[model samples]
Every structure is written in structure tokens, then in C-alpha cells.
Target: MTISSPSSPQEYIKHHLHSLQFGEGFWAFNLDSLFFSILLGVIFLSIFHRVAHKATTGVPGKLQCAVEMIIEFVDKTVKDMFSGQNKLIAPLALTIFVWVFLMNLMDLLPIDFLPYISQQLGLPYLRVVPTADVSITMSMAIGVFLLIIIYTFKYKGVKGFIKDYTLHPFNHWAFAPINLLLETVSLLSKPISLGLRLFGNMYAGELIFILIAALIPWWSQWVLSLPWAIFHILIITLQAFIFMVLTIVYLSMASETEDH
Candidate 1:
């Protein structure tokens, strides 16, 4: 099967941007993102399970060493950020980090490879990176936001959560309204920021890949794409790390008492 270009750049971007949706407009659900994220999560979990099952103290394998390093890093970050004693936080943080990093790493694949394969198989569109989609990122962020609210209420109680919001920073009758309003906005902004940061970075990186692909003279595409792909490794890893750390920080803050 021969791969053909779209009629226009708009068409090209539109083809790449379209998600496998399950519904309409605001209610539309991206089936592609859900599928890819779940797939990646399963893959990550499988790798971790295999490593753990085969782990030995006598001599560490490469996969075991890598997993251990990641675990230690996540453990340290959790230790530093969270002192409220939640058994689930560290594992959750590590999963988020590894899952997101894997999703981001999808951008490293040849821009045309998946689309070409999909087209050959009679599927015209396929976006491999779930985090690159705004809807997916926003959904993850919103989930985290809800978790923050849940943990806040659970750890601090509803009254305490509200009290902290009202009394935080500047605690005065006059400042109460302003403080509450500001605090409310801050809480709402967290998910939006988290979503936007990941979406923007991945979206931009994907766009650059598309642009680079469009510049192909067949022979030179491989040479130019190689360097761009190498540089993108850094971008993907950095975005994932940033997203993971921010999620941990937000969760930790939510779990904090009034003193913190």
C-alpha cells in the first residue's frame, strides 16, 4: 500500500487530530485515548510484575536494576513530599510517572509509521500518544483534582478543609472572603494547569514531528528526523517527570493539615 498526503496542511493536521470518539461534542469520549492509556498501564504493570517476580538479591538483572532505581526515586520523592502516612500514594505516584512517560515516549516513533500501518489495515487514523490529546490530559487532571478533594476531606475533614481555606495565608474577617475566593480559584486551577502543561508539551512535540515529516525529500527525511527524535526524548521525559512531580505535590498539599 502506498501512503499519500492529504490535500492540504489543514487536512493533514485534522486527520492527525481526530480521535476515536464515542459521543458528540462536549459529551464526546475519546475511545482512542482510553484504549492507549489502559494498554500502556497494563504493559507497565506487566513489566513491573515480571521484574518483581524475578527479583534476586544475589545479582540484579538489568530490568530489575532499572525498576529498582525508579522505585527508589519515587520512594524518595514520596518520603520528602508526603508525611501524612498514606500506603497507596507511593505506588500510585510511580504508576503515574511510568505510565505517563510511556505515553509521552510514543511520540518518538516514526511519524508516518503507525498511520501507514493503520491505513494499510484499512484504518485511516491512529494517534499513539494519549497524553498528547487535551481531553485525555484534562480527564487525568480532573481525576487528580477529585482525588485531592477526596483526600482533603478524608484526611482533614470537611470542616477542616473549609477552615483551612478560609483561614489560610491571611486570617481576618475582612480577608476571609478574598482568601476563600483566592483559595477556591487556586484549587480549581490545579487540574487546568496540570492538564495544559502535559497537553501543550506533547501536542507541540507532535506538531513539530508532523512539520518535520512534511519537509521530507524521502532520502533526507531519515537523517533529519533522527536528530529531532533524539532531542524529543528529553522533552517527553521532562514532561512526564514534571507531570508526576506536580501530581505528587498537589496530592501531598491536599493531604496536609492546617499547619502545613
Candidate 2:
């Protein structure tokens, strides 16, 4: 759908960028991000739930077969990357891949579709792509970070965890201070990188779509958008896969026995 005549391209971009937020400053919340994230999650799970219940051995439906394939792919990915045999990792990988994929898939929707519908419904702004929001991306990264911490303690105990941080790569007593700083930064950068990587890719992709819609004539918008959307399909899927793989790798590092 075409957005009728914004006063300028900047105004058009600003309108699309504005989120449905409430409260003040640090306490503010993005209602549209939360709504779409939860909505997409529910939709993803509901479809999977139906597939699970309706699965059959004889001539499975397309949806059921596709889900089974995804389950198998995720299971294989987890088994390959996750060193320890935790049943949770497979399901977690599956959930993360599918959910994040669906979330990123939101970028495929027409740029103005949700916002236009929401405008008519009294909400001023709506960004359909949840991953474009830093908070959502960081929260997912933090959740994985928590799992990494938990598995580290579960496998290595508190003392071993501390020792892993303090003693490695600098065994000399005089080097302990330097080791701690380096280790602390190293440990912290994982989640930071994960969050920023996904956020940057998605935010840029969404912005490009908005810019296309804003700068191009309504009649000519499809010429740019269609190609970008086609390319973005690969990007959306890659980001999800990368997130899943990194989570598996990080958790594997946490749960595995340290090299002597």
C-alpha cells in the first residue's frame, strides 16, 4: 500500500521509524515490538503444535513434512555443535531458529502494510520487524548468555568457573591482573557481539526498505523493493542460523571439559 504524500522524504522516514512507545526515557517500552514479537511467537508455536498433533506416518501433509524436516535439521545442528548430551539444546535450537526466522521474516512484508493498518486502528506507528529493535535482539542474546553461564557452572562448578577465568592463558602469579581484565572483556563481548550483529543487519535492512519506499515513486517502488526482499530472504535465514549456531557453540564451550 502506498503512503499518501508525506511532506518530505525525511518526514516519511521518521514516521516509519517512530515506534509505539510509552513512559519516559529509560523506562520507555516499544509496544509495537513487544506485540509483534509475542504475536509471531504465538503464531509459530501454534502452527508447530498443530503439526505435532496431526503428524502421521502415511503421506504426511506439506506443513507436517516441512516441520519434521526443520526439526531434523535443528536436531542435527545441535548434535554437531553442542558437545554435551543435553536434550534441552535441540528443542532450544529449534525454537530459536524458527522463532527468529519468523521474526526476521517480518521484513518481507510490505513496508507500509502493518503501519497503515495500525494507523487506521488508532495506533500511530508500528514496525513489523521485531529484530530491528535492539532491545529484542539484546534480550535474546542475554538469554543465551544466561544459558552459557548456567551450563558453565553446571559442568565446571563455581571454583572451576573462577579458575577458568583467572588461571587460563596466564599461569604466572604476576600476570593474574592482566588475565582477569582480558577474560572479563572476552566473556562479555560474546553477548554484545551477538546482539549488535543481529540488530545491525536487521535495522539496516528495514531502513533500506523504508528508504526505498520513502524516496521512490509509489509506481516505481516495487522495482527496488521486490529485489531487496528477495535478497533479504537469504539474510533473514542466515541471521537466524548464525544466532542458533553461535548459541550452540557458546554453550558447548561452557559445558565442555577445558583443554589441559
State which candidate has the highest lDDT.
Answer: 2
Off by over 4 Å in 1: 1-5
lDDT of 1: 0.85
- Extract clashing residue pairs from model 2: none
How many clashing pairs in candidate 2? 0
TM-score versus the correct structure, for each prediction: 0.92, 0.95
Encode model 2's per-residue lDDT on 66-180: one tens digit a residue. Answer: 9999999999898888878897899888888999999999999998888888878777778889999999999999999999889989999998787778887787667878878
Tens-digit per-residue lDDT, 1-260, candidate 1: 23455777667877787766778889977777888899998999999999999899888989899999999999998898886888878988898899999999888987678777877877666787899999888988998999899999998898888877897778776788888999999999999999999999999888887876675566787787788888888988888888888888998888888574
Q: Which regions of candidate 2 are displaced past 4 Å?
A: 1-5
| Candidate No. with top TM-score | 2
